[model samples]
Target: MNRELVLAPPLAPPRWYRLRRQLRDAVLALPRYAALLLFGAFTVFPFWWATAAALSSDGAGIWIFPAAFLPNDPGLRWFGRVFYEMPFWRYFGNSLLISTATTLLVLLLTIPCAYALSRMAFRGRNALFVLLLVTLMVPAEVAIVPNFITCAQLGLLDSYVAVVLPNVAGAFGVFLMRQAFQDTPAEVLDAARVDGAGEFGVMCRVAVPMARPMIATLAVFTFVAAWNDYLWPAVVLKERLKMPLAVGIFNDLTGPFAVSTNLVMAAIVLSVIPVVGAFALTQRFFLSGGGLVRR
Candidate 1:
């Protein structure tokens, strides 16, 4: 059998075809670029407005026709005033203390509980976890009165301990840490056990180091949640000195003080810095730690 060979057409495109192809590529890319820029601007505009208003000389004054996003007079005086005029440092210290204590307690309680729940098997384990999930559905407000009575009975009102203890181990923290531990490899855990490691040792040595990223993520989240907590702290702590920054600002910055809207803006900015900075510093762990393997 014999077959005839056929000549192939030229593979290269003509110049106009190439230019039209390039134009099509550019057109397809335009919407993505436009969406990104629009999203970025929308996200950034609020921060800019808050910052500009915080620095404006007439922050509390009526708006002018030609609005300026950047203040004509930028000053640090409000920052100083925030500290000096309003028992700000005391509130700051209280917030710092309560938030730190809460985060630590959360880590201490969550790590072991989550690790055990994830790694160990016992009777009613599923039921217990389900119960915890049920508790999450119970709105925090429902517990406030009972918690208040308990705090009163324990003589913990007006104290940092009152604020810190009730919120120390949240359902979300447990769920998050549990998910993180589950992502860890079972083989790694088995090897640790084979190497003379007890259950506690295995968890501390193998599981925790592997989940550092998740832990850091949880720590930042817990700290911020506690730092921003207002209702519970307000109910427990009557004294202004004992109040966290949230309640302190709401209480002292109003009525007699009437918390200048600009000063309030400054306070809001100051409050946000720590949370943003914490996430920025630990975001690598948060992003990278979400894998399903040791490597």
Candidate 2:
């Protein structure tokens, strides 16, 4: 007996069914996308408003509710005047120096301290960390009087060192670094020691290199804090030329911007550019898995 074999029609999903599945997935993802968009807009709107206000001629007809997104009459007069009307370049330089130096110092002090706290076995380690954590809870204003007195006695008042000295030993950087360094594997560090790498060598060659993401994160925060510092520096740095951008901008904006809204907005816009650029550059580190080596 011969058997006849026949193939049934393929059980493929219809085109409309596939389309429906895709639509469902997109609908499920829509809320997440919406949340991200809203957050982005919330974060970016202030910057956009400042930029738009700066470009608008005298910010005329733009300060009202439902503010104009685009300027009706844009001009660079305020931007040009920002430099000409005051000693802004000197202030900018002072801010650059202070912020950059503060960032470097924060890294130098924080990384080593964090490494020791995370890797070394020592007495009072937990207690010391707890003490540091307690310091973070203290309001910065409480330290202002002591810092001022110390600077005055040291004759560091009205100097760059005065401006930078107080901010160097930030607890936040150390805390962040400690968290980052703890994630590093001890076995890898032990292997490095077997290869004749001492503590310093291991730190420089291996741990430091691998922890770039957190380092960058701390650096950006330290830099921004330093750059935007007005109260402490203003209290310490009395010299007219020694003022940072924040102090200088606030000082200058008082009189001229009373007559023109554009000047005030322009100053805000300029003040933010350096910080925004720093953030944009360093954001890649946090995005790249917070300094963890994938391998």
Candidate 3:
């Protein structure tokens, strides 16, 4: 008996075929690239316009045809005026203190709560989680009056504590962390326990390390919220010295610099810098989701 042998082609495809496939993929991806660029431009244009307005000599260029997007005579005078003419630094400091405090407090409260809810079996755990979800549905406006009264009774008005207290913890942070913890591999947790690690040790060493990305994501959200919060801060703080940038800008900048569009834009730019930087630092965690695990 005899058998015929068949020849096989090389592992790599022909050059022409590879080029054709690459060309096809590029052509197919054109619409997606176009959409991304369009949205990116749409998102970036406002910040560009604001920056141009802040830099413009008279800020009249912002209203002009093509100059609205491009400043006619860019200068740093408005930015200098932002500091000289108002308590911009004070507002910035207040916001920073409140936002930092709020983020830390929210993390401290949510981490243990989420760990317990995700790993521990307890009575009324489901009911407790449901109650938390219900809080998310309730309008924050509904709590404003009661919160104000509580703050007043505690004599915390016009202080950093007043502003930070209302925002220190939130149901959203707990829910996000709970979801992340629940996604962690149970085997890893069990291994930690088998090594003589208690529940607290397992949570601290195994669970938290796995959920670092979610924790970063929640921290960024909480910081951004606390930084940009206007209503609660405005309601609780009466003194200009304690007002965060969001509320201070509205109450103070609206009075004199309202007409000075350049100064107003400069102040806005300053307020936005911290938020953008914070997000930029933690952006990878958001993109990586729960996969940014520690080794």
Question: Which predicted model would earn the best TM-score?
Answer: 3
For each candidate in turn, give its C-alpha RMSD to the true structure in angstroms: 4.5, 3.6, 2.5
Candidate 3 — worst ten consecutive residues by lDDT sum?
286-295
What lDDT would each prediction earn against the true structure? 0.83, 0.86, 0.88
In model 3, state the lDDT of residue 56: 87
Task: Compose the digit string of candidate 3's lDDT tens values, residues 35-63.
Answer: 99999999998788889898888776678
Off by over 4 Å in 1: 1-42, 60-68, 288-295
Estimate the TM-score of every prediction: 0.85, 0.90, 0.92
Q: How far is candidate 3 from the true structure (C-alpha RMSD, Å)?
A: 2.5
Residues 31-129, candidate 1, lDDT per residue (tens digit)? 989998999999987777767777876774424423657774788777777787788778788988998999999999999999988999999887888
**Full-model lDDT, candidate 3:** 0.88
Best-first order by lDDT: 3, 2, 1
Put down candidate 2 lDDT per residue, 217-272, tens digits, no spaces: 78888999999989998798777888999998887788665676778888899999
Model 2 regions more than 4 Å off: 1-12, 288-295
